[model samples]
Target: MYAAARSMSRRVAAAIAVFVVYLSLAPPVFPFGAVVVHRAAAQELDDEGEFSYRRDAGNGPARWGVIRREWSACAYGHLQSPIGLSDTVAGLADRPGRLGRTYRPAAASLVNRGHDIMVRFNTDAGGVLVDGVAYRLRQMHWHAPSEHAINGRRYDLELHMLHQSADGNKYAVVAQLYRIGRRRDRTISRIEEYIERIAKRKDHEELIDEVVDPRRPVRGSTIYYKYTGSFTTPPCTEGVTWLVAQKVRRVRRRQVRLLRNAVHDGARRNARPLQEANGRGIGFYYTSPAHGMVATGG
Candidate 1:
């Protein structure tokens, strides 16, 4: 009887030990945390008149976290975004090939969300894969004066392609930087008139669905920088995958002006201020003409 009781005790102890190990090794998962977006949650993300880009304003970037209870991450979260993209701070997260994307043309619609213009995919737009996990393309938006600076130099404009994971518990953004040049950007040219229409409309909703392509010059990046960061705006969710292109594209100054002018008064220059690096490392995946597709070192 004593031997049988001892044997049962050992089994219970071993089971507890296994459970403890599993808990320690498991990855911390937050709800869609954008686990990361739903139609209602995506709508909540649009910059309503509640926030402002003006630094001095009461409701500006500095105070975004305090403006609401749920947005505490904006003020307190350590892994924030828009850090200056510099090689000096690069990490050894380099991997093979370019970003994994299977994006195609899908039904999409445009919306002027007061702070910036957004193109939301209406149908089953494809997605990009990160670390073997798939994130679906949700929408694309613009930011003037570029959010994340390259080597400490800011650009004329920035494009954010927001994506949510297959289960909607994660979010990723593919950011492209553009400088003011003589030639207009093809992606912007494709929708500049539609932006004007949004600016002119009172409701700020463009009810038409267009077949928008998420491929090409947008997805054909020979080089890019990847880092873990947060959405530039509120609840200022952390754990976002920020993949910024190293090569800067060009857009006409007029086009840049149009994006800024299309927004409302305070948000005409719709860009969140650069956040703290917090010892985070930017990873470069370079495939320049001079250097073929190769992952650079730490």
Candidate 2:
């Protein structure tokens, strides 16, 4: 009887040890490898708007301008959408049969400020005439080091110009890729000059005199790869139309260096990684003329 009791106690101890090991090795129940899950939680706990580190208070007006006057009661929404192209491959066949054949470009619009960089635009607001149909511009923003890979290649920067319609339905985007080259962008030039002046003053109130023309000459074919994706940031809202422009714009190496020098989390990088395409179809639009319209996509 004594021997049997001793053996049973030993087995119980061994079982407990095995159970502890299993708990340690198991993946997190909520989100083992979800990047969005972690970011959302961090954003929620971060009060005092510390997550908006880019909006530096010490740098004063020079760095971010007069906040009270410029920003005003703009609804400080926590659910700001992220910008990216989708790659999911399901339910693609159910899309409108005119998916590739129908083209619209009339919807495009540009805004000078709000989030990152100096200017932002929404394509949904502006309509572009493409093959006669008016496609509205949705939204626009930048991604450092680019996002879409061309034959496994990346560029210095990329601009996503998303577009939709007047009825707040349907979606499209114009993507303009940029690289460091000899020819400079006039719009970028104006922004750089202003930034330099701001850096010199450091803490002075000044009305920005530079005017940035959103329209610029683009090289390469107007061919584009289209897909449906979600915002690249928190909330991870889905159903964003993506249009990555085939052509690439050129900016001087020094200009890129300037952007790299800006203070972001005491570092100079502000970009998100490419999300899973998840088997989404990427449509190619070639042979289309450079259509003019205002749109915003970020």
Q: How accurate is candidate 1 locally (lDDT)?
A: 0.80
Model 2 clash count equals: 49
Query: What TM-scores do the predictions have?
Result: 0.77, 0.53
Residue-level lDDT tens digits of model 1 in 1-298 = 9999999999999999999999888866665354455445434534445778899876789988877789999999999888888765564444433467788888878898878888888898898877777899999989998999998899989999999997889999999998888978877788877888888343476744457887854745667788899999888999999889888888899998888888887877888999898878677644442333334532
| Candidate No. with top TM-score | 1
> Relative to the unseen true structure, what is the Cα RMSD of model 1?
16.0
- Scored against the true structure, residue 165 in model 1 reaches a CA lDDT of 91
As a TM-score, model 2 comes out at 0.53
What is the C-alpha local distance difference test score of each model? Answer: 0.80, 0.47
The reply for model 1, stretches above 4 Å from the true place, is: 1-48, 91-98, 200-203, 217-220, 286-298
